[model samples]
Target: MDASDGHADREWRLIREEAWPGPMNMALDEIAAETAAAGGPRTLRVYRWEPRTLSLGYHQDPDTVDWDHCEREGVGVTRRPTGGGGIYHDSHGDVSYTIVAPADELPGDLVESYHELCAPILDAFERMGVPARFAETERPARHQPACYLRELHPAHDVVVETDGEERKVSGNAQHRRTDAVVQHGSLTYAVNAERHLAVFADASVTPAAFRERVTGIADHADVSRSEAVGALEAALADWADATEGSWTGDELERARDRASEKYASDEWTRRRPGRR
Candidate 1:
């Protein structure tokens, strides 16, 4: 894909798809990244899961999550290529976004890349009149286990102050492939903290120990779903020309095939033995 002016062509494609299973969603993102690299289009997708699901980080141990509990609770479990802790996704609490672009379209380094990608989220929150800023520190506090638990540098994260209390509202993760970079994250509007605690509370994780490590947007920013989406749209519009659309037949088919072959396999999901 050549931009006449030596800059990436500012094209944004937005997709809203019906709730899909975990592997399928991951596959679609991989496919989108490849498509974008081919100069097809820079794409953003918003999707959900039919049944609630738990997604673990690429290198995270599946055992870290209580699979017995998830299975009993009817929540599906899948792994993501990105590095981060696990996340629980429910209908009302979750909003996920995926950005697919050529490397040149982003920053020169990983840290800078995160900032460029995360700007829209910060802008969105600001548009909502929320005073959000990125955390300046790179070191994690003693008890912080997940990315969201501690603020890291260069990540386009959302931090806000309400009632004189500071908190984080959103966090993101990225996966850089040979062809392009795919960054995806969730803006947690609400969280079932108790449910998450219940699932994590076990011999491995104590309820009191993990409670201080997780948070949601509802904890700081008081905005409705429509408001949040609108803010995001406005913010994204400032950076690129967003075109609302759906996945093409070819893209969907490729994603489906990849999901079955790679994302659904235990070899890929449980790559490390004696871990899960």
Candidate 2:
């Protein structure tokens, strides 16, 4: 992949941000997608959640979350642009990554793009000596309120088999606009699985029941957050013609503006943004 024969060195930047509020993270991801759509270089962004947050799917019912519980627990609240069950990220405990690229760099279809985009995560797990594979079976229709409690969908996440059972280690979701795709996922270093279920009042998601289905890297192996990030960084840079760069002033401003105007706003988070 040199700069010739239509295989030019595709310039992309890798950003490692300190833990940020959920709104900021969502804003930055949207900015990345806008940049890519407007013919900018691809961007790979990684960071952790500060003020630990629970993010709902863009169209997920806000009523699904226990507002009283969230307020009492002092957890942050926001909604992702992608659709899926709500996700709970422990404060400074999960390694989250987002990739924003032009459609040309990804498979046009959503399902295919999930597998293609998730390869780096699978690669990272493998580099850490973890035998992770995609769960190739379609998900059964169960109305679970949290992703960890929901059944695994084919290639929706990276999982490892243990104790004759498969447990998910990472989960990803994507949002695509005209000519850009933004995919984000979390590789959990550790988590209090029982605590996460508290945000949702789903009767079926009990600690003793769903905890067995929820496992992270720390649960199965000695992998550290830095190790996972490093492996993913190498895989991503190799997968694309990424160059080391930082966010420009304009980019940061736009992200902040987006955060305040959309992600952090009641109109967006309280309900489906622009949903008919």
Candidate 3:
């Protein structure tokens, strides 16, 4: 069940877990890359946040958020190891995914690598009867504090065509290590653009305008989390040699340590690290 089985079969170990808090979720994703780099199974993990939370990018300033709104809603906030804009993880409306693989298994070009990892996700959307496609043109950077508020990354988004317009459905970020690559993204079942917009400081986009830029899978199909995961598994199976798997006790312990010592730590989350 390990990648050391020679490159004869590109076996992807899939791990699916229930909703967890922001710190644990982010820590486990880091562990996914570490797991692969050490010659363990390359993994794909899918999970969500409990009680919901707002996850900021590695370099983002927490002070930029409208903390007043976050406190009122009882939402926890933490930072992601990956770089990107902040995202609102709604337990009821979002499903998140993490992909870990040997760097050799992905494209050397970062942009092309985004396309490579996104293929199975696009297939998963298609299986749900949504005709999702990659953004054909480059999107001008938004520099907005929030993720859904930003324009699509020409290479990173999964968009669905609607009435002659292409609306993005997901936002992703990846990190390349010496021997492995880790990418994490979120797919929404519904869009609560208003609630998401409230947390960002001085966001000019209104709720009505925000609705025009993003779409959810529920727009095209209604499937439970398990069903959506099954679709992803089917799609990944088509892309690489894959198998279902579980996490070990040590991975759990390491992840907890990472969460408490890094992700949930004020010093780590508050200050930006150099180059990931």
Q: Name the candidate that leads on lDDT.
A: 3
Q: Per-residue lDDT of 68-105 in model 1, one digit per residue for the tens? A: 78779987767788887666777777777788888767
**Could you give me the TM-score of model 3 versus the true structure?**
0.90
Candidate with top TM-score is: 2
lDDT leaderboard ranking: 3, 2, 1
Computed on alpha carbons, the lDDT of every model, listed in order, comes to 0.69, 0.78, 0.79
Which consecutive 10 residues in model 3 have the weakest lDDT in total?
1-10
Off by over 4 Å in 1: 1-8, 138-147, 150-156, 162-165, 201-214, 220-222, 273-276
RMSD of each: 3.6, 2.4, 3.1
Error of 2 at 85 (Å): 0.5
> Residue 88 of candidate 3: its Cα lDDT?
89
